[model samples]
Target: MSKYILPVSVFGTVAGCAVLLKQYVTGGRCPSKATIHGKTVVITGANTGIGKETAEALAKRGGRIIMGCRDMEKCQAAAKEIRGKTLNSNVDAFHLDLASIKSIREFAERIKQEEKRVDILINNAGVMRCPAWKTEDGFDMQFGVNHLGHFLLTNLLLEKLKESAPSRVINVASLAHIIGKIDFEDLNWEKKKFDTKQAYCQSKLANVLFTRELAKRLQGKLRWLLH
Candidate 1:
């Protein structure tokens, strides 16, 4: 037992640090018991990961969820699963390809025309550290998908969002923004060699900045959260 003491102690210390780090990073559970019955919610990239999970939670709360994804098949599957889990059939799947500006416009147009009200919009779609690729409009993929796409979509839907006052917009930003810097001069990386990691960080920074400016413009009209 004496010979094994050092190794056991080191392992225990590492485990303890990991637990603490996770708790710190995850923050804490939301304490609100608010339910959003009769509310309409739009979530981008809701077919997988955090976006899917968010849709499920909102569905449970009796919200009408619109899942916007590039792949209709995956989105439909996710919508069905969420409906089954939450026993709420208000979940609908819609196509939203953030890589294309035209697609974004069309999605926004469809939402405005069909949806009676837009109570909550969650901007959750993103690409991370992808190889150098440009969007259909020649914009950098990360910036176009993560920031500009959502930016345009949100702006287009502003009227509907305001029509349904006391609405909310949630942006799922990354902690990587802490070290991110925007290169206004080379926003699309046209002049410099592409750096995937830096591009991702810059897009995340743009997300935060865009959210801030939007919140200021909306003022007391709507609630917004960036995380």
Candidate 2:
């Protein structure tokens, strides 16, 4: 390599490292909402992506996990994988198809019957850039699974979380949420053209709104917002 090219590459690498260091020191998050160690954490869509990775991470830190996914077999596989990787052997599987209200209700009922408390509930499931579709209840697919299902699930689990005390409810929202607005009347996409990006963004916005509303209603020694 030429001397000039070598110097330029060195400069770029140093600058990138410096920027990352600055962000780490000044802009990164602090783990402050609530501790998850030994706590019961229920994460939806725990079979893949960030959800699965997060479950593994929490398991390493000693959190008891319930992997909620659409497919029970997939959830079981994820739980097995997480168990193989972490100190937590308490991980197990459960069913949660976010598109179905009946499924959500059934899952909630089963959880209520079996578990008396839930210490951490991470609403990490989401559908992105999907074609327009409606759930059985006739709500738009993105909004139905990504927002309303979690909406009802969280509400159903509220008493347990509150009773557990100092619990955390983390809702993962995307930057897409910034550009979206809820058309309450047109939620089903009845009169409008279907756009994948719009549907995703609108649904993500609803997640944020629901999180804020829930925090407002249940703060003082009971709930926390872990974004």
Candidate 3:
């Protein structure tokens, strides 16, 4: 019995540790019980991953969800799934290609014209490590899609956001920013040899910095949150 007790205790401890590790890795679950019945939420890259999960969660909370993605087919499919699961028909999909300024402008214009208010904006779209690629505007893909795209979208929607004062803007950044260094001279990677990892890190760092600056500039006007 004594030997058996020791093994059981060891197993219990291991199980407890594993549970804790998983919670830490996944950032645990949201504790908020608040609901946003009529609030409007616009999420970029909502076709999959973090963005999709966020849309579903918000939809469950009764917020109107607008999902923006580069792939309309996937975005529409995801919106339908979320609507079915959450029973929230407010979920809709819109095409937004961060790699192209034209597409971004068109999406923003549509949102401003169609949506009455923008309560929350989640800048969750991002591009990670990939071979050197340029945006339609001739900028590095990682930096262009991750930072510039969100920047422009946020700015373009500022009027609507301001109208819905007491609104929130959430920018999803990464820990990779810790090792990032921005090169102003060759921001587009035109002069320097392209490094996908470094470019991704730099873009993440830009996200952090941009959020900070935006928060400062907005001061008492609005709230900006970073993740």
**Local distance difference test values of all predictions, in order:** 0.95, 0.85, 0.96
Instruction: Give a tens-digit lDDT track for model 1, residues 1-227.
Output: 89999999999999999999988897767677789999999999999999999999989999999999999999999999999999999999999999999999999999999999999999999999999899999999999999999999999999999999899999989999988999999989999999999999999999999999989988999998897
Point out the higher-scoring one by lDDT: 1 or 3.
Answer: 3
In model 3, the number of clashes is 0
RMSD over all Cα atoms, model 1: 1.1
Query: How big is the RMSD of model 3?
Result: 2.8
Off by over 4 Å in 2: 1-37
Candidate that scores best on lDDT = 3
- Write candidate 3's Cα lDDT for 4-81 as tens digits: 998999999999999999888668989999999989999999999999999999999999999999999999999999
Candidate 1 stretches with Cα past 4 Å from truth are none
Q: Candidate 2 residues 134-171, lDDT tens each?
A: 88899889999999999999989988888888787888
Query: Arrange candidates by TM-score, highest first: which order?
Result: 1, 3, 2
